[model samples]
Target: MNKPERVKLFLVDDDKVFLKSLEIDFLENADFVVETFPTGELCVENLSKKPDLIILDYHLNGIEKSAMNGISTLDKIKAVNADIPVIMLSSQDKIDVAVDCMHHQAFDYVVKSETAFMRLKTIISNAFRLKKVEKELKWYMNKM
Candidate 1:
């Protein structure tokens, strides 16, 4: 894929170590341009910096300024770009919360598991694949 065409991935999580590791993994193994934020606010600020797929953790470490919740962050993000695909990841198995997020328009919900990172990779890949098709269709339509 063209370097410019690589999917841009934004990560919002409290865990710095984990986020960094994920960045390294995506850089080395996946067809993504990864940007990870240790807090939700920074991620929100960077949304306009670039736009693509997003991976959000349910519980963030510093959320007081941001209402300290993933859903709130999601709301803020959607305010800016509703069509951006966001995969919400939570260690908690709160069905209600997941349902609420979905109702609010989350693309997908994932509970932390043994291979959560791998699952994230799959989700990103699938989303990008679909986006690629959509882009091609739009181009063809414009040409026609």
Candidate 2:
């Protein structure tokens, strides 16, 4: 018997405290192989590592005044590998912001709140389940 591969997650947030807290939560409660990035530029640069999922901050320039924002970074990630699922995260609860991120191909939009971790867990599970279905469909199609 073999252990399943852990999900690799890239968490991109400019707020050091929030980023660390989220990282710790996932590490302590889940079996994720997590990586944290303070700037969206760094996350974009490391896309070659091929994370299974990305939770990106909406305002990535909060600390780095000149850093790429989450939408910009999301665009870059999609351009590199559109198949990778990205979940846009923010402290804002604006509908417009959520809609905009969805327009950019985000798998989901999560607002930072007490329940965010639980919501994220559900979303991550759904994303991987969808991917598995798609993969099986493709395999069957190829067999035809």
lDDT winner? 2
Residues 62-111, model 2: lDDT tens digits: 87788999999999999999999999999999999999999999999999
Candidate 1 lDDT for residue 98: 88
Clashing pairs in 2: none
RMSD values for the candidates in order, in angstroms, are: 2.8, 0.8
> Worst ten-residue run, lDDT, model 2?
61-70
- The 0-to-1 C-alpha lDDT of every candidate, in the order given, reads 0.82, 0.96
TM-score of each: 0.81, 0.97
lDDT of 1 by residue, 1-144 (tens): 664777788988887776777778789888777888877788888898776988998888543545457887888889899889999988888999789889777888888776888988887778879888999999999999
